[model samples]
Target: MRHFRISFLVTFILMAVSGWWGYSHGGMPGLINALWITGVLGVMEVSLSFDNAVVNASVLRHWNEFWQKLFLTVGILVAVFGMRLLFPLVIVSVATGLGLVDVWTMATTTPDVYAKHLTDNHAQVAAFGGAFLLLVFLNFLFDDEKELHWLGWAEEKVNALGTESLAVLITMGAVAACVAMGPVEEKYSVLASGIVGIAVYIGVNWISGLLEEGEPDLQDDEEEGAAPAKNGNGDLVKTVARGSIGGFLYLEVLDASFSFDGVIGAFAITNDVVIIMLGLAIGAMFVRSMTVFLVHKGTLDEFVYLEHGAHYAIGILALIMLASVKYHIPEWFTGLSGVAFILVSLWSSLRYRKRHAAQA
Candidate 1:
């Protein structure tokens, strides 16, 4: 509840604004309808993003207080306004060659046209986002250093083949296959976008690694009387130096990838960009709050398999996004798939805990 206090406050404020916006547009009936739709959209975003919160927590727990505070403050603004509101507009502007003002007009005055333009470019969007998320999942899946096996024999088998470059090779292969099977017109665009996605992932990690080089070695810090913190793999946590620029960039890009599905799917429920932003913003805030809660509570340390479940869900989401390039995947199915993975993983964690306790 303490972690969620600000989230609840923001929700109330947004809902009130939503009501006013609705009333001004259409009166009492509009107010009621606006509240209802906003609630639904908020729930949809939260449901679709539970795995996102878990994954975010996994990264955030390693960060210092200053960076964590920055994440909650500045990062939330980026997630809500930058990703949810402005990102779609930017995409539409680039795709349609419309100026920002004209695009804004189109979004507000002629929402259907705006949505069509945005959805028209879905193939490229899906390709880019899918490629990045695929790499994220693959990197986690093939990490031989990760000792905990969530899926038992299956995980062990995958871990056996783990190597630093394996994830990249697999992702590149996936992109190539998609390009070959895709429409001839979109082949070049898909390939280019997928490559860019991979490049961004590698670049961010490389830069972050460079930044981390300046920090004191984990073993040295432990000997100096700093309490040692071990991660899920039992490796000593490295000190985050001077604001962790790499981790910040990685988190932002990851949020953008997750936002792709929600932003595009919102058009199905309503074409009004204002209502969509308001609703999605509420949901995005809650996701950030959930991330903070998980970090502060040390929930990940307790539930070892939660991170495994989140990465697995991310993998499924990456596949779904790629598949959606050619087929219509229901939004309900997308949200439900993620929830199912999280629930199963949580159950596995609970069982592992009980078994370990009994053995002790």
Candidate 2:
């Protein structure tokens, strides 16, 4: 309850704003409709992003207090305003050769046209986001040093072949396949965007690695009464105090990737830019709060396979995004797939705990 206090507050404020906006446009009926849509959109965003929160917790658990607070405060601002509002406007501006103000006017005054312009460029967006997310999934899958395996047979084989190069190769192959099979006109854009995504992932990681080079390794500092560090699999492991900038940048980019699809999908529900932003903003707030809750509660440590499930969901989502570049995959399917993985992994974790307890 305490962890979610802020989220609930934000929800109320946003809903009120949404209701007022609706009333101004269409009186009582409009207000009712606006509130309904806003609530639905908020739920949609939350459903689509639950895995994002879990993955965020996995990385955020390692950060110190200052960075965590920054994530909740500054990071939420970026996720809400940056991604939800400005990002769509920016895309429209670039795609249509309009100024920011012009794009904003178009979005507010003639939302359908704004949505069309944005949707028309969906292929490039999908390619870049899908490629980046694919790399994220592959990196997690190919971690050779990973101790626990959720699906041992498959994971062990892949982990044995773990190499950064292999992950890149697979990602490149996926992009190439999409390019070759996609619309002839879209091939170039998809290919170029895919490469850019790969480069962005590599560049961000390289910079993060460089920044972390001199940090004190916390792995060897295990002392009496000191809490042991835990991996995503909930296994005790060596840890390090990482440079905050790299982690911060990594998380921001990750949030952007996760949001690309949601922003685009929001059009299907409503073309009202104000509603879209407010609804998604509410969802983003909850995600940040959920991440904080997970970190404070040590939920990841307890759930064990939750991270694995999230990464697996990410992989599925990446594939779906890439596939959607050429096909019209429904957004509901994407959201439900992730939730399914989390639930199954959660059940598995409970069973594992029970078995271990019996053995003890």
Candidate 3:
């Protein structure tokens, strides 16, 4: 109860600050709309990002107090800057060869037109992102470890390009090339953007795995750094340690991957970039909070298969993204469908818990 109160107060403060800022710039009506839009976007983002929380909890459980703070503090900055500011710019740069300042002007001035143009061409983006996520989802289904042979193969072939960092750098270069030459040189090559997105995802995962191996094992230092105290039997208490900052960052990257479609799709409904950001940011915040809530409460243990459902949702979303790359499904339809899947999965979790309790 105490935690929940603090969470609500924090959320309120942040939203209020955002409202004041928006109001100062755009007047009362603008502030109200910003509140309403960001509010709505926040709800949608939470729902859409539920799976993200589940995934994050799994990774964050291992982190120590220091890195955990860093995860929240630094992670928030990364999300705001990387997703809110730079991401849209990246999309614009890829779509049109415009400078960042010019893109910002266009995004703010004629946001509706910018949104519509992006929405109109969403199929390609969806297809690419969808395909990549699908591959990730399928890999989870088939392989337990989810290793990236691509990077490993590169390590063998090219001495300099073999490093994990180099692999990602090169992959980004390829993505830029694909975005540039692939579409312009050959009209059919527009599909290359999503391919690049997939390649990037792979690179990121490989890099994360490589970096995660560097962290000290938690069990080794558990005696010196146990959590505050356990209320009940130790079974329910998670051993806290500084886990992988890289792991959480990787999760954020995946969350961004999931966001690509939603961000573009949101534009189809309305063109206000501010509205889009407001809504999406709000949604993302809720999701992040929910993730922390679940972690703190050990909700995953309560609902054993909740994580599975989320991964499945990720799979479905990935497919939707891929389809969007080439097709024109209604934006609302994509969001609602994922929502439905998650609901069904949640229900299953409840049922599973009930059955187990009855047997016990």
Best by TM-score, which number? 1
The candidate with the higher TM-score, 1 or 3, is: 1
Residues 44-83 of candidate 3 have per-residue lDDT tens digits of 6666667777777766766655555565666656665677
**How many residue pairs clash in all the candidates, one count each?**
0, 0, 19
Using lDDT as the yardstick, the better of models 2 and 3 is: 2
Ranking by TM-score: 1, 2, 3
**What is the C-alpha lDDT profile of model 2 across 1-360, one tens digit per residue?**
899999999999999999999999999999999999999888999999999999899989988776788899999999999988888789889989999999999999999999999998888888898999999999999987788789978888888888999999999999998788789988999899999999999998887787677554555555445575455533211122353577777788889988878998889999999999999999899999999899999998898899999999999999998888889999999999999999999998898889888999
TM-score of each: 0.93, 0.92, 0.73
The lDDT ranking, best first, is: 1, 2, 3
Q: Please, what is the whole-model Cα lDDT of each candidate in the order they appear?
A: 0.89, 0.88, 0.62
Colliding pairs, model 2: none
Model 3 RMSD, rounded to 1 decimal:
9.1
Poorest 10 consecutive residues by lDDT, candidate 1: 232-241
For the record, the alpha-carbon RMSD of candidate 1 to the native fold, in angstroms, is: 4.8
How would you encode candidate 1's per-residue C-alpha lDDT over 183-216 as one tens digit per residue?
A: 8998999888889989999999898888788766
